[model samples]
Every structure is written in C-alpha cells, then in structure tokens.
Target: MKTESTDANTSDQGLITLAHGAGGRVMRQLIESICVEAFNNPALALLEDQARLDMAEIAAHGDRLAFTTDSYVVDPLEFPGGDIGTLAVNGTVNDLAVSGARPLYLSCALILEEGLEISRLRRIMASMSDAAGVAGVSIVTGDTKVVPRGKGDGMFINTSGIGVIPQGVELAASRCQPGDCVIVNGTLGDHGAAILQARGDLALEADLVSDCQPLHGLIARMLAVCPQVHALRDATRGGVAGVVYEFAEASGRAIRLFEDQLPVRPSVRGVCEILGLDALHFANEGKLVAVVPREAADSMVAVMREHPAGRDACIIGEVLDGPAGSVQISTLMGGVRLLDLPIGEQLPRIC
Candidate 1:
C-alpha cells in the first residue's frame, strides 16, 4: 500500500506511487520522473491525450499501409537472452516487416505496478533506448499508468507500429501459390525457451537463450535481392507451425514441410525434450516464415544466411494444392504427421 509522493522525487515533484493515477501529486511525479524522461519529444512535450502524426504523405504512393499493435506481458519481465525492453522494440519491428511494411515509428505505453524498484525501471528504460537506437525507429509518443502492486504485473509494455507498404509488393497468405518454397529465417523456440529457463519454472535445464532481435533489416536485405517474395511472417507466438498454418488457410493450400530441413538449435531441442514441449509450436522472437517462388528460394535463403540473425535460415517446405490450410510434417522417421494447432496453452507463461 505505497502512497504516491506528497512531494515529487525532485523539489518540483514527489516520489511516484499508486495514487498518481488518482490525478494528484503522485501522478505528476510518475509522469515527470519516469514518463517524461524516457519518452521526451516535442510532439509529446505538451502532454496531450491524443497524438497527431505527419505521416499522411506516406500513403499517397499508391500503396497500402500496414498498422499493428501488440502488448508484451511475459513473466519475470527479464529473460536469459533479452529483457522486455529490447523485446518490445524488436517485436514491434518484426511485426511491420512480416506485414510487408517498412517500419518507421512506434508508440509505447507502459503500466507500472506500485512499489516497483526504481533501479529495475531504469535498467528497462536504458535497454529500450539502446534497442530503439539499433532498430532505427523512433518512440514518438507514450503513456504511463500506475496500479496497485497486486493489481498488475511488475511492468507491462504495449507498442503500436505503423509502416508504409512498398509498391508492387503484395505479400499475403492468399498470394501463396503451389510450388512456392517455404523458408525460415533461423532456429526456433529460443525466445520461449530462454524465458522459461530463466524463470526456473520448468524444472529443466539447458543452455538456451532467447532469439529476440530486430528482423526488419534482414527482411529488407532479402527484399532487395528479391521482391517476388510471396509472403513474410515472423515466427513469434504459435511458432513456425502457426505461421505456416495461417498461410495455408489464407491461401487455401496445403503446406508440406520436412523435419530434416527445419532449423532447430541444439539448445532449443534439448530444452524442449526435457520440458515435453514441441519446438515447432514454441515461440521464436527473431525468426520468420517466408514464402518465395520456387526458382528464387535458393538465392533468398543464401542472402538470409549471410545476416547474423539468419545464419541458420533454411528452406523447409513448399505449398501444395491440397486441402487448403492443412500443415503436414514429414518426420525424420519416414512417417507423416499432421500438426494441428494446440487446443490450449501447453506451456503457460512461456513468453
């Protein structure tokens, strides 16, 4: 039951507390100390309710635009390979890339529980600054809310992104055609496994780390080599299989994949085996499922592997004119299996 600052952290304001959201002294300190410092900008200087952006010109190019928003609520707030700060930045970037858009900017919203450690908050902010710097996207606007300690997680971040779709690149699952080769950007399940390992909630052990990273650069590089890329999707939640199933259903085609060609890191496989989770269905923060024309698959893959985040990229499967939206796996044991989506959360709180 921490109280909001009757006096600001500085002489100008008091320490922040839950009562800040009550529209009083506490809230002002939270805004001035945390919010104002982390997201200082001219557009946000006025502290208005709504944001007015000068992005209307990007749509006049006779190309469609893409808008997406997501919330990151992973437990522990920190993980082995990355913390939520960089994770939030890269996550939003990858979303725009997979949608065939060139990500330009992002808006961040943070929810802080009362009594949160100021040190932890500072570290998260620093990580976010570095990540945003690397991804080349600006955090133009943001909002902050404080809740009672038990009312919410220690910290929650929501990011909304906007990007301009390039002309002549219509990448959607419906555009997937038979004979299109399926390409994956890199090893799978690293992000989810890394979070779980760091938490010690799974009671299993392995040297797994999250693959969370910004993939927009890699996607841009690949597009420069070949824009005929039918579609691009980041393997986040629902993992590689989820993205493939989405394309199959959207295009009314069957996606056939081979186990041998699928990229799985040694650490990922070892962790999943101990935890009884399927690597295919686990999450990947820094990978993608790309659909390339059969003739151009090799070149695209080669280009992807040249990038650090795409070293293990592989061409794992192809689309076929079968019962649309079905994902079939050819196991290394010479048996075929259907990869139906999991009914419920097999690994809850896995990131």
Candidate 2:
C-alpha cells in the first residue's frame, strides 16, 4: 500500500500545474484524492497499472469479449444535458452495446490542461462515476496527464470499454437485407443543436439538450424481443444519416429514409432551418438506429417504446434493392433525393 505524500499540498482550490503530471508525490495524491475517490471500486483501489479482471467471471457472461475505445473532445466541456465526462463513458458503452455485448468495465484516461481548475475536474470525474454506475460498469484503471495550458483544452477524456457478447448473438452491417426496416430510437440532431446553442457563437437559443445516455439496457431489451436484428448503430458523429450510409455500403444495398418520419424535435428543426443545416447530417449522442426484418419491425419498435430512452422509437425507412451504396430520402414534397455524406466537417469537436 502507498501512503499519502506528506510533502504535497492537498488543497482543491488551486489550478492544475505541470507538476501534477510529473511522476511525483503530487501526481499520486491527485490520483488518490480525485480519480480513485470518485470511482471507488476494489479493482481501482488496487491502483495497479492495469485492471485484472477475472477471466472465469467474464466468460460466464458470454463466449467472446468485445472491446471498444473512444475519445471525447466536445467543446464547452459542460453542455445542456451532459459534460465530456458523461459522453466519454456512454459513448464507449454504446459502441459495445450495438455489437450485442453487455458492457462491463471501462478505463478512463484524462488529459487536463495546466491552469485548469481542480473544482472543474472534480465535477467531471463525478459525472463519469455516475455514468459508469448507470451503465453498470466499473472504472477499473485510468491515467491522468496535465498539458501546458494553451496546448490543450480544459480537459479531454478517452475511454476504453470491455464487454461480453453472448453466445448465438450476432449483428453486423453486412447482414442487412433489402426487406429490412430502418428504425431510430428517438429524435435526431438534438445533441448537435444543444452544443451549437451552448457555444453561444451563433447567438442561438433553444430548449435543446444533448441526448447523451447509455444504451446497453435498452439494447438488451431490444435483443430479447428481436433476436434477429440485422444491424445496430448509435447515431453519433454524423447522425442517423451517417449510420445508414455505412450500412448501405457494407451490405451492398440502398437505404431510403422518409423525411416526414424522422423524429426531430421542434427546437432542433428550428435550429437547422436557421443554419440551413439538415438535421440528418447533425450529430447525436443517445440515439440508436436499428435494422430488423420487416416482420419484426413493429414488435421491435413496441419493445423500444417501453423504455424511456426509446419512447420515440419508429421505423424511418427500409432497405432497397436499388443502386448499391446509395442512401436516399423521400422528401415530404413527394420526391426522392440522394443523400450523400458531407464533404467536410459539418460540426467540429462535436463528439
């Protein structure tokens, strides 16, 4: 066991300094007081270089292990519904969940800027702990580094998650078929809209909040009812449109979404109209897009609606046998138009 360093100042009022990242007493004290205290668990308490998970325990849940990693750099750190910390935890969890895995453990690595407030770091870590608890995962190991003040943002988080995929379960974009139905769990682009408003650069205002949340529980329920789901993806960086496009390319099929069926919040729509940005091209955090056989579409939507995260679940489109790797939208004007991925960044630093 390591004892607390008597030479280091343990006050929470000061800003992060380069010394905090140096391999010294200050760094150890920071880890113990902030990260370990926020995410209290036996494995993390061990303070080892890596988490030693029990293989037997992990194998009992499933036949294979699923691992995923993601980095969060959303601007403003704190947004309407969640901060970068919460996004880091949930985003990685969703990556595993969409693969039909039960997320279990996560490792958090933080890059904090020198001169960053310790109080802010505390809040962020607390948020991460809460999100991990909600997702039923443990933060077992992590690393922290402090960068020069202007060289880094206030904070950046990178999370890697480990999960177990049960036997007899498989999902992939390549499995999609022409008769599959496309569904989204909720509205699109809320997170993008929320971040835009929070930035204050556009002088925009709305009641929008990021749809940031963990989806493993909802996905488990979805799989329980519709085991034959062809593909699953959470709408993130490039929103629902991005996910459908990937499915089209991978499956060698075309996907057509109905403009009227996209569940966009009024506030989000307003923001899009003002910026001339299509909500389809915006980003989302908590929403997922699923593909299921035509026969199971209604039942899948029904099961999804029973969960709070998916109350707006609805079929947005269907797979098509037309040109491969093409995505189209049936406009409300009774016309179909090709939807292509954006040329450049539609919105940067939008997790």
Candidate 3:
C-alpha cells in the first residue's frame, strides 16, 4: 500500500469535507478508527481497492453472476414517495437491471451519527425489508457504525448487490447507430424536484413527489419485445441529458431530440419555471431512455404503453451521423440548438 503522508492532529469536524479523500495518514486514521471498527468483517478486513466477492455460495454448475454496489445519502433522509431505506434497495436493483441481471442478494453498510433516533432507524429498516421483499431480493448481511453527532450526517447507506445475467440477454451502450429511435418510460424531473422541494431550495412551492420506483419489470417487458435494444440507461443522476449524451459519445453518433416528444409533468414544469431549472436536466429515479432500432420502434412503443411502468412512453429523439458525439434539440418553434451538460451542482443531496 502507498503510505499516505500527512501530519497528525486531525479533529472530528462536523462535516465530511474533502478531507475524507485526502488519502493521507489522517484519512487512514479515519477509516481505521471509525469505518473499520464498524464493519469489522473477515472479508472486508482484507481491505483491497476492490471488494473480492466470492461466488461459491451462489454459483451453480456453470453460471456467471453479476455484482454491483451503491451508496445513498439523500438529504432529509426521507422524501415524498420513499425514504433512504427504499432508495438503497431500489437503486441497487436498478443498477443490476441495466447491467442485464436479475437481482438476488445484497450486503448493507450503515454509517449513523450519534444521537439519531433508534425509532427512526427501525422505521427505515422496516421500509427496507418491505421494499426488498417486493423486489424479490434479500439482505444477507450488514454492518453499522456511529460517529459523534457533529462528525457525521444523520445516516448514510452503502449496499453491494449480486445477481445473475441469463444467457442471450445483451444490453450495451456502444451498440447505438444512426436512425435509431430514443424512447423514455415516463415523465422526468420528479426525483430531483422532490429532493429540492424537500430541502426548500426553490423560491416557489408546490407539491412535488419523487418518481422513484422499481424498473426491473419494465425493463424485462422491453427486453421481451425488443431484446435487440441498442442500449438502455436509467436517467438518474444528471437525468436524460446525461444518459443520452453518453450514448452519443459512446456510439460516435449525434442525437436529435424533438422538444415536444420529451415528457414533463405540469407540476414539474411549473416548479422548474419558477426555480430556473431545466426540467430536462432534472434527475429521475424510476425512468429510463432506451435506444431501439427503427424497424421495431412502433411495435416497441405499443408494447411499452401496454405496461404500467411505460404507459406514458414516447419516442423523444433519433440518432444521427453528423458532427459525432453532439446532442442537438429541435426547438418547439422550429429552431435548432445544442444542449450543454449542466455545470455546478443544481440540487445537492439528490440521488
């Protein structure tokens, strides 16, 4: 291991500032003194860059399984449609789903601040259990640690998930091509707006609830109809722009999106108009943008609309071959413009 260099005398500050990534002696002390003691497991004790997950338990005769991990620290710890507990489970499962896997089991890690209500923790745990049951996954193991009140946030959750990817189900980003159609499951900006609303970040106020829900069932239905999907990406962090731009860059193509085709709820548009945030750039937890071949576009949309998760689905754009890796939008008034990636944090602590 590369020994981190730093002078001693680090204090328990109130926030998890950039110091956590300083990678110096002070950082090691933080991991050892708190994180390590909380999650003192033999496998994790090895402490390598990547967690070496053994598959002997879930392995069958000749099966290859998938493994993924995610962390959750949404502000307020609770939100309109869900709290942090359901967030952790659904987030991890969605990661596995986009990877073309059926989720099976999970391991959880918790960092709790001192003075947190035990009753609140119980509620979160109960929510997690119910969500996991609904998703058909299990929480096999976990670890917990308590930081001094000022030194930690209320609660942070980390989950590592494992699943199985059956044969002949391939989904990748680099498969997009010119003339392919882009589709979205439902409305956007719900999760991001809800998070912002909960934090009181916007000047105007209205009831905004997150669109956070599971997508495995929807994804499976899409795969059933058009398993030849060029790509499938959940519009989570940076929303549809981030995922579509990524596909353009990865596939060496340009994206042309029609403004009217993109779905935005009236509630979200009203809030964004007052707050000065683009609903397109807002994050969505339960929605996805799928790139499908033109030949299957109409049929795919028909099938998607039949499913509850995709009833509001629409073809938002088409891939093009001009000026590679650029995203162009055809304005509602018959003009064209390039959409740029958002700079700086718009809403903080939003999943």
Candidate 4:
C-alpha cells in the first residue's frame, strides 16, 4: 500500500487511490490542491461544512430565487469543446439563467473513481473554476467522494446553483400564448454530436465540438430587448423538439415549427443524417429555446444575432390558436409532420 506522505502517492502524476478518499491527510491534500486552489473564493476559502451568504445581498436582487441542480456524467470525461467540469457549471448556470435570473453561486460535488489520474482531476477542477469565473458565479461549497475502480466512470460532477430573478420578469412554459414566436439561440446538436464522436462509437467523423457555454449574458440581452418573453428553456438533455413539445403541453396550444429555419451545423447535420437521428432530438449544452410575443419576434431575432452567443439566432416556430397540446413541423420539402415527445432515449449519457 502507498503511504499518504509518499511523493509517488500524493503527486499530480499519481493515481487516486482509495486512501485519497478517507477524509484524512491524502483527502485533504487532494481537496486543497485541486478544489481549493482552483476555485479560490472567500466563501470556499473558509473550508466550512456549508457556505454562508448574506440574506441582504441576495434579497437586493429580487423577491424570488431561482435554484437548480444538475449532474454531468458525460463519457470520455474530456470532450472536443469541454469536459464534465465545464458541463456541470454551464448546465446549472444556464438552468437558472433561462428562468430569468441572475446566477450568483454554486456548489460542486465530485465523485471520483479509484485508480483515476490525479492530473486529470486537476485539469477538470481548473476547467470548472474557469467556467464559473466566466459565468460570474462562485463555487461556494463542494464535496468529494471516491468509488472503487470499475464501479464508476472516471469522474461525475453535480452542481447546484442559486440565482435571483429580477422584478417584472416572468418566464414559464404556461405563459405561452397563441401567436407567440418560438426562437432558438444558435445552431443545435453540436454538444450531442460532439459527445458521440468523442466516444468513438461512430466510424465517420467531422469537426464537432460541444456548444457548452454560460448563457446568462445572452438571456439578459434578450430580456432587455423583450421583457415580456413568455418562456425560455435551455435545450439540454431533450433538445429543441423536446422543449417545443413541453411548451405545447404546458400551454395547451399547438406549436408550428418551420423546419428550414432551424439552424443546424453542417457537420452536426451530416452526423445526424448518417446515424439516422434527428438533430432536433439530440442534446444541446449552450442553445436556448424562447417563446416571445409575436410583436417582438423580429426584434428578438435581430437583437439575438448581435450577441456573440446568439449570432445564429433565428425564428423557428410559433404557437397556434387551437389543436392544443401538439407540435407540428413544416418540413422544407413542403410537407407538414407531427412531432411527438421522444418515446425512448436517443443518446444516453451524452451530457
């Protein structure tokens, strides 16, 4: 057995042994070198069991709090554009942001498998720290655990976030109304396609990277242009089609989507075509689906295109007056097709 003080066991070049999770010297070393050093915030610095925040500071933003939690178990751990760490941060942040909130803080929990490389842990931690900084949020608290080899993937991350929704902003699925324009903020399916390629499951390959990013800034920009936005959802696990179907069911209205207007990257489209999959059903990490008043549709798309994160934004659909709780797509081939909720999983563990 490797001793805790041994350089071979504690160094970054070393592998994470079960001893590293025992809540002793080795565990403390791992936490300090990777988690503490990387995240480096006053709240995290305290090393307390839980993070404490001033209620006054939180209450100043809004009367409501937006809280969300997500877990990332993407295969390959590291992918073309991001890793599980980046995914964990961006996923939680986007969830809060899409609900019309200003994201503020996060809690990170890591599950590491025994025999994993210490360097990999460091790299992921650095990625998480950088992602949190980019989103203007802090990793206020975190926990770590280790599982036996073969019992777990390299690493899994769970992040919980809290944000404040500014006054006068109401966004929800039930807010959808007839004539509301459905808009998508940029190309879809890059994240899912990228993950599939990363897993080496498909023989064909093209340049694809996960569209993982913080969407708070983009959401804020859209709200500034149209505060009356009915609903906003980050199309993640279920993708655009799932989101539209959800909107239809929640609002008890029909949704009509223009197939030609949906922005799809050529590479992603090719991959989906070859794999007999629909890009609309694949997962996305950075894209958003918005339902806004018809009057603000053109203005929303125009403003979205001006933002870096939304340069490819466009109107893809709209809500209808009747034939409630269903979605139909107007195909580019001039035929209308009904879109149903995905019956089973298309891609598992893509996120």
Which candidate number has the best TM-score? 2
Better of 1 and 2 by TM-score: 2
| Candidate topping lDDT | 2
After superposition, candidate 1 runs with Cα above 4 Å error: 1-16, 56-62, 203-205
- State the lDDT of candidate 3 residue by residue for 254-337, as single tens digits: 999999888998989988888788888898888889999999999899988998878999999999996889999999999999
TM accuracy, model 1:
0.91
RMSD of each: 3.6, 1.6, 8.1, 2.4
Model 2, 272-349: lDDT tens digits are 999899999899989999999999999999999999999999999999986999999999999999998888869999
> Tens-digit lDDT track for model 1 on 58-174?
666337777889888888788887788788888998999887778877888888887676667767877887788788877777777888878777888999987887888777888
For residues 151-244, write the lDDT of model 4, one tens digit per residue.
8788888999999999999999999999999999899999999999999988855999999999999999999989999999999988999999
Error of 3 at 187 (Å): 0.2
Error of 2 at 154 (Å): 0.9
Q: What TM-score does candidate 3 reach?
A: 0.82
Q: What RMSD value applies to candidate 4?
A: 2.4
lDDT per model, in order? 0.80, 0.92, 0.78, 0.91
Candidate 2 — what's its lDDT?
0.92
* Candidate 4 off by > 4 Å: 1-8
Off by over 4 Å in 3: 1-63, 203-205
Ranking, TM-score, top scorer first = 2, 4, 1, 3
